[model samples]
Target: MNRYYWILGAFAALVVLLAVGLNLNPREVPSPLVGKPAPAFRLAVLGQADKTIGPEDMKGKVWLLNVWASWCVSCRQEHPVLVDFSRRGNGTPIVGLNYKELRGDGAIDMRRVPAEQEVPMALERAAGWLKEHGDPYLLTAMDIDGRVGIDYGVYGVPETYVIDKAGIIRMKHTGPVSPQVLNEKILPLVAELNK
Candidate 1:
């Protein structure tokens, strides 16, 4: 029947669309922020509430703005690579934006706590994690409540942006930064931007 043929055609179309989508890499999602000025933000340094840092501080120097959180499993996976890179003294300063810190290990939700206690609690957790692993950031800015992350169009944690000396966002990587991504994409770009 004609009706049966129409339904089959619709299902086939849906299948083709899904196949195309599945073949695409989620990490390569294009960002509208690319080629635009990095969003401006002045956030308190993690564990150092008295101090603050922002994109303006890094002007005239190529830098990496890495969005991470204590709760992100992927961030843990990506941390060592960053630590190694920093140890190499590549001259590219990496500024960490600690996005929405929450205890992700099936523990109490940090949101239920009093507002005044939130930052300290998050800082405690993040400090412990960094100590256990390694702190790669030149300075880590605490983006409590993730407001800065929202301004940067963060869909999730563990995102990274390469900002040139002009403060324009050159590249946005949406997922964990593997060693290959660092060596192949980020490092090369940073080298070019620094020149």
Candidate 2:
């Protein structure tokens, strides 16, 4: 019994050490998107019948992509910031990935798709959302099939990423971008891109 107790104690200590070591030695999983080019997507405005939009649409310009949904209140919270950010328009335009909406059809009539458990988020609502709050993004598209979201490693709505002029992702933010984050992180990053 004494020998068994000693063995159990030693095993417990080893487990604790391994846990602490693992936590300290964090590893960054190679994002399939890191070194290579970003995944291409072609989509259109919610109700506009004007033109088709795709990654190639903005080629040669530094941009930002936000993964958001109408059903996500946090996304709603971040919406206005996007508007404000666009108002700055430092040549870095913001775009939206409206996850939870179809496949194939580039033109997403927000009025038509099931809005994440049937919650509606029309372009008018998005426009109103910007009007009441302000407008930032130049392009906003419906990721009806969630394929774009998965490609960008999005586990939730309201996440934002800064894609460089070369189309490589330069930054990732998982929550609402606060004013502090904007001033401290976003501005500096954008400034560098501009130079």
Which one is best on lDDT?
1
Q: TM-scores for all candidates? A: 0.86, 0.68
Q: List all candidate RMSDs to the true structure.
A: 4.0, 6.4
What is the C-alpha lDDT profile of model 1 across 1-195, one tens digit per residue? 999999999999999999999999876769999999999999889877689998999999999999988778899899999999999998788999888886433466655888888778889988898899999999999887788898999986799999999899999998899999999999999999978
Report the Cα lDDT for residue 194, model 2: 66
What is the overall TM-score of model 1 with all chains considered together? 0.86
Say what the RMSD of model 1 is.
4.0
- Would you list the C-alpha lDDT of every candidate in the order shown? 0.89, 0.69
Clashing pairs in 2: 83-135, 83-136, 86-136, 101-144, 102-144
Model 2, 45-137: lDDT tens digits are: 654657557777777877888876555677767676677777765667887766764232245554566656332344545545545655566
Off by over 4 Å in 2: 1-32, 101-132
The residue pairs found clashing in candidate 1 are none
